[model samples]
Target: MGIVINQSIKNTVITYIGFAIGAVNSLYMYPHFLGEDFYGITTYILSSANVLFPLMAFGIHNTLIKFFSEYKTEKEKKQFLGFVLLLPLLIILPIFAISILGYDSIASFLSRKNAIVYDYVWQIPIIALCMGYFEIFYAWVKVHMQSVYGNFLKEIGLRILISIFLLSVYFQIITVEQFITATMFAYLISMLLMLFYANKVKPISFRFKIPNNAKAILVYSSFIILSGSVANMLLDIDKTMLNQYIEIKNLSYYSVAIFIATVIAVPSRSMHQITYPITAKLMIENKYDELNDLYKKSSITLQIVGGLVLVGILVNINQVYHLLPKNYSGGILVVFLIGISKYFDLILGNNNAIIFNSKYYRAILFLGLLLAFFAITLNMIFIPKYGINGAAIATLISITLYSIAKLLFVVLKMKLYPFTVNNIYALLIGLLCFFGFYYWEFPFHPIINIILKSILITLLYVFLSFKANLSEDINSVIIKTLKIIRMN
Candidate 1:
């Protein structure tokens, strides 16, 4: 628990720093320097890669984490790592060949609604391949509980590189096409760095021998592929489908709003980096009491922290859009819908870790597939009529339903729930702060307004939450932080 808090706080700080850089990239640099059309192209290409990377990785990244702890002997662990490391190539090579063989048809189809996508369509598979392996190596570190350095690389290093690339474009040192090419190189570099660091963490001695549990590993990896694909599809399918239905520039607007809303996910993302392998270990040890305790604490803590971010975003959303170009302002509704959906997911705590590492993951995978289908259908129906807002609505509905399903599955199967009285108090605090401050504004610059409003909101929300004792874990941290401040 101490490590979880220590690392989660560090990861949260790192992730928010990344998000801060991303906000500049998404809101300012990309749109202003690259132009909306090219920004949309970049967003679409990355989203498409996200949707494809799962298949290319063959789910080995997740497989590594789930099975790494189960191996007791060093030799067994080496065998498992060796097998999973090579597994993705089996899928990656075929996908590369297919991309080459089917290039024209694939390009033509993707470029049907927007021809700008045609020339750059090939970058998708390359980036996806890079992203796939990056995750594989990232998991290699996570099983060793060395998540902070990986988190820093993922959360800060990549974005800083992108920021530099965007600045290069702004300075006319690189053309838009060059900027796109550099983006691909960025992912490749990230993967290589992670691989190098992973080896440093635990020197890899590839056994080149199949583990005794090869069949189980293969089966789990196969299920994980669908689960991973479904997860990615739900996230990026709307953006991909939007490319098929709307002008490319509209995606730029949607991307801005989505980025703003995604800031709310920082806490969940940070916490999951450490909690995931821990959850796997606890499940393997059959420590239900500790697992359930973790379940509740993770839920309340994330809800409280994530709730503040959500309130801050919603209250300041208009000001946020104010700083953006006028063309990007159409996604106000998108932010609200997506933010709410993200909040629902945040409150679920480590539900994903619990389920993904459990025996009942197969059932959740089926449900995920159904939800993916529903998301796509909803996007197809809604995007043509409602545009970007439609995509947000589809995402909100799909995600909320998916979160509810996961919560139910965890409770019914594992007899564990993640809510307490603190949950309701946290919700009220978020709502009260949002409604109370959203309509209030400062007669100053949008940036200044944002800063002032955020400070007031944070002080009020934190003070109230602390007074209410919404989470013992959080209150203890507050106490310690205060003590440190007083001592200083």
Candidate 2:
């Protein structure tokens, strides 16, 4: 538990730092330097890469984490890791071959909606392939319980480099075309760095031996590829589909709002790195009581922190949009809709880890595929009418449904629930702070108004959280924080 909380704290800080860097890139550098159309292209290419990478990786990243513990013997572990490492090549080569063979028609099919995309469409697979290897190495570190360095690379390194490139564009050091190409390859650099880090953490067992259970593992990896693709699709497909239906510039606007909203999910993302393998180990050992305890604690702690972020975003949304260019202001509703859906997911802590690592993981393929289809269908119906806002609505509906199904499956089938009585109190706090401060204003600059409102809201929320003792884990941290500050 100590390591879990400690590492989670470290990763949370690292993730927020990354988000802060991303905030600058999205809100200022990209808009001010790249302009809306170019920023739209930037977002489109990256989002496309993200959506495609899962299939290219063939879910070996997930397979590595799920099956790592099953092999207790050193030799089995080495062979298993060896097998996982090489499995993605089987998928990647075929996809690359197909893309090259059908390059003309494929480019034409995608470009008809927005011709700008055609020029850079080829970057998607390259970036996605890089990302696929990056995730594989990242999982390699995760099973070793060393996710901080990987998290830093993931959350901070990439964004910081992007910031530098955006500045290069601002200074006329490079053309937009060169900048885009450089940006796509930056991920390749990051992935290579992780390969070194993984090897350093534990020198790779480069043995080419196949494990005895190779067939079973390959089947699982296939299920995981579909599962992983659908998961990424749920997160990323809306932006790609938008390219098919609207002017590309709208994606830049949508990307900004989604960026602001995604900050709420950082805690879950950070905590999951360490907790995932822990959950897997517990399930393997049949430690149901301890697993349930971890589940509830994680849910409350994440929701408490995530709820605070959500409220802060909601209250300050007006000012945030004001800070952005006028053209980017239309997706305020996108922020809220996406934020709410992520919150529901945040409350279901470790639910995904539990399900993906359990025997019922195959069931996820069916459910995830259904939701992915539903999301794309809803986008098809909604984007023609609603544009970016419609995409958000489509996402909101699809993700909410997807999350609800996962939560129910975990509870009904596994009999493990993450909600606590304090869950209601935490929600009430967020809602009260949101409504109370959202309408309040100051006769000052927007920055000053944001600072003042945020301080007041945070203070009131923290005071109430402490006084009410909403979570023992959080309360303990608060106590320790105060003691450290006062030198007690």
Candidate 3:
């Protein structure tokens, strides 16, 4: 818990900084500098790459995290690491070959509706490969219980680099085309840096011999690739489907709303960085009590923290949109819909780690595939009719259903539940803050209004949450901060 708190706080700060930079790029720079069309193009390409990377990595990143603790000897660990490192190439190389052999057909199909996508079709795989390898190295560090640097590179470094590229576009130092290329290069650079750090953390011995448990490893990896693909699809498929059904600029608008909503999930993302490996270790050791403790603590802690973020965003959503261009304002509903789903996801806590590391993973994988199909079907039925709003509807439905299913599976199968009385308290507090502050806007500029309102929301929310003792971990931190301030 100490390590989790230490690293999660650092990672949370880093993730928020990244999101701040991303907000500027998505809300201001890209829309204002590159125009909506190219911004849409950039968003579509990145989304497509995100959906593809999980497949290219062949799920080895997650496989490494799940199995790394099982090996006893350093030799055995090296053998496993070496196997994990090269295994993705088996899928990546073939995909690259197919991409080369079938570029025309692939590009033509992808660009059937938006011809601009054809020119960037090649960038998707390139960027996906970079993304795939980066995750592999990130998992490498996580297994060693050193996630902060990787989190920095992932959450802060990449966004900073991309911000530079966006600035290049703004000053006319680079054309939008060049900026797209720079975006690809940015991912490549981040991947290489992670690879360097991973090696420094644990110098690679490159023992390529297959471990004795090759069959189990392969089985797990197979399920994980499907699960990871389904999860990524659920996330990025909206933007991808939007490219096919609606004008590309709508994706830019939807992306802005999505980005604003994504900030609510930062705590989950940050905590998961450390909790995942810890959960893996606990499960591998068969420490059910500690595992359940972690499960509940993680849930309430995230619910308290993420619930505040959700309320803040919802209460000030209008001011957020007001700062954006008129065309981008259409995604206000999109933000609300996606924001709720993300908050639901955050409350699930370490549910994903529990299921994925458990033997019952195959069931969840099958459920995820069904949900992925459900998501795609929903998009097909809705996107054409509702446009960006339709995509948000599809995403909201798919994600909410998927989240509920996963939660039920863990509760019923593992007989472990993440909810407790604290969750109920947190929910009530969140609801109160939302309704209390939502209609009351300060008479000032949008930025000033948002700042004042957010401050008020944070003060009231934190004060009540602290008094109620909703989370021991959070209350402990608050007490420590107060003591330090008093001393200073």
Taken over the whole model, the C-alpha lDDT of each candidate is 0.93, 0.91, 0.93
Quote model 1's TM-score: 0.99
Q: Deviation in angstroms for 232 in model 3? A: 0.5
- What's the residue-level lDDT of 414 in candidate 1? 91
Write one digit per residue (lDDT tens) for candidate 2, span 326-386. Answer: 9988999999999999999999988989988889999877999999999999999999999
Please provide, for model 1 over 1-488, each residue's C-alpha lDDT reduced to its tens digit, 9 standing for 90 to 100. Answer: 89999999999999999998888888889999999899999999999999999998999988999999889988788778888988888888999999999999999999999998999999999999999989988999899988999889888999999999999998889999899999999999999999999999987766678888899989999999999999899889999999999999999999999999999999999999999999999999999999999999999999999999999999999988889889888999999999999999999999999999999999999999999999999999999999999999999999999999999999998999899988998999998999899999999999999999999999999999999998888999999999999999
How many angstroms is residue 28 displaced in model 3 relative to the true structure, after the best TM-score fit? 0.8
Q: What would the TM-scores of all predictions be?
A: 0.99, 0.98, 0.99
Stretches off by above 4 angstroms in model 3 are: none
Off by over 4 Å in 2: none
Checking candidate 3 for backbone clashes, the offending pairs are: none
RMSD of 3: 0.8
Q: Roughly what TM-score does model 3 have, to 2 decimal places?
A: 0.99
| Candidate 1 Cα deviation (angstroms), residue 325 | 0.8
